[model samples]
Target: MLVLFLLGTSSSALAKGQKHTYWHLTSDAGEEAGKEFESQLRSVLVQAEGTHHTTEGSLAELLDQKPLKVPSCFEGAKLCTTVPELLVEALGVDGLVEGRISAAADGYQVELTLYREFGGTPKVVTRSGADLEGVVRDAVGALFTLEAAIKIYTEPAGASVFVNGNLVGESPTRVQVHEGNHGLRLEKEGYEVLREDLTVLPGEVREYNATLVPKVTQITVITWAESAAVYVDGKLSGASGAPIDVMPGAHSLELRANGYRPIEITFDIAAAQRRTIQLAMLKEVEDPWARREQAIRTYRLYVEAGYALTLQSIGFAGATADIAGSTYSPTSFGGEDRASLVFNGVKLAVGYTMERLGLVFLGVDLMVASMDSELILTAQDTARRESAVGQGASHIALYPLQGTFRELWGAFGAEAQTGLGVSFDSLNGDLTGDAFDLSQTAVFWSLAASGRYYLSEEWSLTLGYRMDYDFADQRGLRHGFFAGVGFNLPLLVDAGGESKDESLPEQLEEDVPVEGTDVPESTLQKLEQSGTEGGREP
Candidate 1:
C-alpha cells in the first residue's frame, strides 16, 4: 500500500485529545461496499486513543431525531467541503473528519479530509491500497500525527533560521516542527550568530525571540610618533596608539602629525577582530628661519696674499740737496726724487655678517707689506746717483659699510676702507762711496677702495688701490695698487640641525612622521621659536 498525507492547514488542530466527529465515508463501488467501509472506519475511530470520536448516529440523536443529510459534494468527489460547516452548526463539534473511497486499478484509493469548526480549508490525507480496511486504518493514523508549532522572532527580522542544521526560513516566521529535541540557529550579517537547543511537546506553540549582538572590529594603531591624529574614512577618530572601534569592512585610514610625514592606508577588517598597525613616520623640514640661518654664511675668515706697487714722495720746503759736495736749490724736489717701490704682502681678516639685517659685515682687517725702492737723484751736470731705500707698513683697515651685491654677476661686493698704520722707512747705500743708513718710523693714515669677487662659497679674489699719508716726522705721501687671491673660510651658524632641500610649504604639507617617531628636540625648539618670532613681527 502507498499512503500519502497532505495537510492544508496547520497540524496543531490534529494534536492529541482534540474532539472530532466522524462523518460518512462514501464510495462508488456500491452502496453495500460504502456501508461496509464506513462501519469498519467508525469502529476503528471508536477504539482510537487521545481523541473524542462522535459518530453520525450519536450526532443525530443529539439533535432529537433530526434527519442528517450528507452534502451532495461528498457522494463521489475527492473532497467534501461542506461537512465541517454542517457538523459545527448541527452538533457543535470542534472538528469533522470525512473520506471518499474510489475503485483504482490496483484496488481502491481513499482520500481523507479534516476540517475545523471555524470553516478554514480542510486537511486531506490520501492513501491507495488493495486492502480496503487496512487503508482506512492507515489514513486515520496519518491524519492525527503530532507536530509542534514554532514561532521564531529575531531582533533583526530577516535572520535565517535553521532547525536541526536545516534552513527553515527567515524569522519572524512560523514553522511546524516534529515533536522532539532540535537545534535552532539564527544568522544575520553584522550580527553574532545565535544558537539554542529546544525541546517541544506535541501541540506546543513555542515562541522564540532572540536579540542578536552586533559584530565589532577593534583597530589599534601604534605609531612611531606621538600626538598623531588618526582618521578613519576621512573622519578624525582619535590620536594614534589608541583603539578605534568600527564595523567590519574596508576602510581608509590616515595618520598625521606635526613635523612628520603623513601616512594613508586602505585595509579591510574582519568581524570581532583585533588588528594592530605599527608605523614609522618620516621627518619634515618646515621652518623658514632655520633654513635661512643655514643658507646664510655668517662668518668669514679671509687670507689674502698679493703683490703691491707703491709710489713714495717727500716734498721739500726751501730744501737744498747736496750732490758731489755742491749745494743747489731744487724747485721740483718732490716730483723728481719720487721713489717707486714694489712690495709682496699678505692681508688677513675676520668678519661676521648680519644676514638677517641684509648681508652687512663688520670686521677687522690687517695688512703687512715689505717694500724696497731705488731713489734716483739727478743734477744739472749730467750726473746721476742712486740710493736704495726699504719701506714696511702694518695697517688695520676698517669699513663703515661693507656688504655683498647679490644681483651682480656671480657674488661680488665693494667696500671703502679707512685705517691707521705705522710705516718704517730705511735709506741705505748713498750715492757717495761712504755707506750711510737712515731709519724713520712714522704713523700714517690710509684711504682705500676694494672690490671682491667670490670664486666659491669660501674663496675669493680681491683687487684694490690705497693712498697713505704720513703724519709724524717725515711728511710723505704713498700710493699703492694691489692684486691678490683670497681664501674665505666660512663659519656657518647652526640652524638647529642639518638643512633640508625641501621647501617649507612642501615640508609642512606632506613631509611628516606618522607614529612613534620623533623630530630632533633642537630642531623642534628652533622651529617653534621661529614661528613665535615671526608671529610677533609685522
Candidate 2:
C-alpha cells in the first residue's frame, strides 16, 4: 500500500489565467497488478477534473509520436523531476503525471510523480502494496483543489490593481488565484496609493473593499475686498480668485491689499473636503504725523471771534470841602459806597502757533466794551454819582499746552493758554457834574483755555474761558467765557496728507573734521539715497 500526504494544497495552483492542462501517463509491473493497476490509476487521476485532464494517448497523438517515452518528460534526470520544456511545448500542457507499478515482496510497489512544467519542483509518492488503486486515489486527492476567486472593489472605481507587482486589472475586478499570500496594490490619481498583503484559501471566495483617502484638500479663498494677495504659510500663492489644493493640516493663511489692513488666519483642512472661508479687509487708519507732532504740524493757524463779558471797578477817595461843614468818605464816592460795573464785549483774535517751540503763539486780540462806574460825593450834605465808559484792545503772546483725540476723519482737541500782553483804553468820567479824563494804558496778562471740535479737515468750533488782568493801578480783573469759530490756513502752512517720513539720520558738521575725511562710495551713496546731507565739505 502507498501512503500519500500533502503538506498543503494551494488553490492558486489554478490561478486565473494560469495554464491548467495536464497529461497523465502510466506503466505497470508485477504479475497480477499489470493491467488492473493501470486501469485503476487512470480512474483516480480523472477525479481531478478541476485541472484540464489530457490523456497520455492524446498528448502522444498531438505530438505525432508512438510509444512516447514517459521518462523523457524528466529530461533523463534521475531523482530530478520537473517536466521537460520541450515535452510541455509539444503537448501544450501545464504539467504531467507519471506513474509506475513494479513487483515487490508484498505483491507490488507503486511510484507516482506529479510535475508542474511551468516551474517549481515536482511531488512524488511511492508505496508497496497489493492495492495500487487506493494509493493513486489518495495522491490525487492531496495534490489538487479548486482555485479561490478574489473580488476587489474600491469606493471610487477604476483603480488599477497589481498582484505581486504584476498588473492584474482595474478594481471591481475578480481574479482567481491559488490560496497563499499575495502582494496587492491599488493605485489611483489624486488618492493615496494602497498596498497590502493578502492570503486566501482553497475554494474560498474572498472580497476586498477599500476606501482611499485623498492626498490633497480643496480650499477656496474668498474676500470682501478685491485685488488681495493670498498666502499659504507665508508664501504668496496667488490672488483670491480660485480654489487651492493644499495638504491636509493646520495651515496659516494671509490676505493683503493696498489701503487695507492685512489679516492672518489659521485653518485645519480635512482630506477631500471643500471649504470656503470669508476674509474681511478693513481700511487702515492714516496718521501723517505722530500724535505729538500733529499739533505743531497742522493745527497752528486759526482765526477766532467771540463775545466776552467784563467786570470793572475803580477805587477813589475824596473829602467834601467845608463849604457847609460836611465830610464824605472815599468808599462813599460812588453813591452805593462801591464803584463796580459789569460790561459786555466782543473779541476777535488771529494767531499762528509753532508747536515744536512748546506751542508758542503770537496773536492780537481786539476787545471793545462799554465801561461804566459811578462816584458819589457828599458836599454841603449833598450826595452825587460819577460814571465812566470806555473800550480797549490787547496784543497778546500765548503759550498753550494742547492735547487731541481722533474721530472719523478729524479730531477734537483742547488747549490751556497763558498770555502776557499790553492793553490800552480810554474812558470819560463825570465826577459830581465835573468832566475829567479817565484814560489808562498798561501791560496785561490772561489765563485762557479752549475746547475745539473739528467739524472738517480745516474748520472747528471753539468754546473758551479767559481771565484778563491789567497792571494799571485800581483796575479790576476782566474774566469771561467766549465761543468762536476757527479756520486752518493751508496756504500759510502745508499740512501734508498721510505719508511716511523717509529722511535719514545725519551726522552734525561739528562732529566732522574741517577737512572732510575720506568716505567709501557705498557709504556716500547710502547717505545720498537716504536724503541726508551733513558734515563739512572737503
What lDDT score goes with residue 43 in model 1?
45
lDDT of prediction 2? 0.55
Off by over 4 Å in 1: 1-188, 191-216, 223-227, 231-236, 246-248, 252-265, 280-350, 354-362, 376-396, 405-538
Q: Report, for all candidates in order, the number of backbone clashes.
A: 13, 11
Model 2: per-residue Cα lDDT over 1-538, one tens digit each = 2211111123223356554544344444643565676566545543354554433234433344424554553432222233344465444457655666777887667776666665567677777765565555555546665455679999889999998898899989988777688899999876899999999765456799999777867777665356679899999877765788777778998888765467787888876677776554443433432322343345456666666565555433232222224444333423544345554555666665443222334444444434354444444355642232222222222223322232222266666667576665544444444444333456667777777776654677878787877766666676777777777664334355344333433221111111113444444444344443331111
Please give the range of 10 consecutive residues that has the lowest summed lDDT in model 2: 507-516
Question: What TM-score do all the candidates reach, one by one?
Answer: 0.32, 0.40
Question: What's the distance in Å from true for residue 129, model 2?
Answer: 45
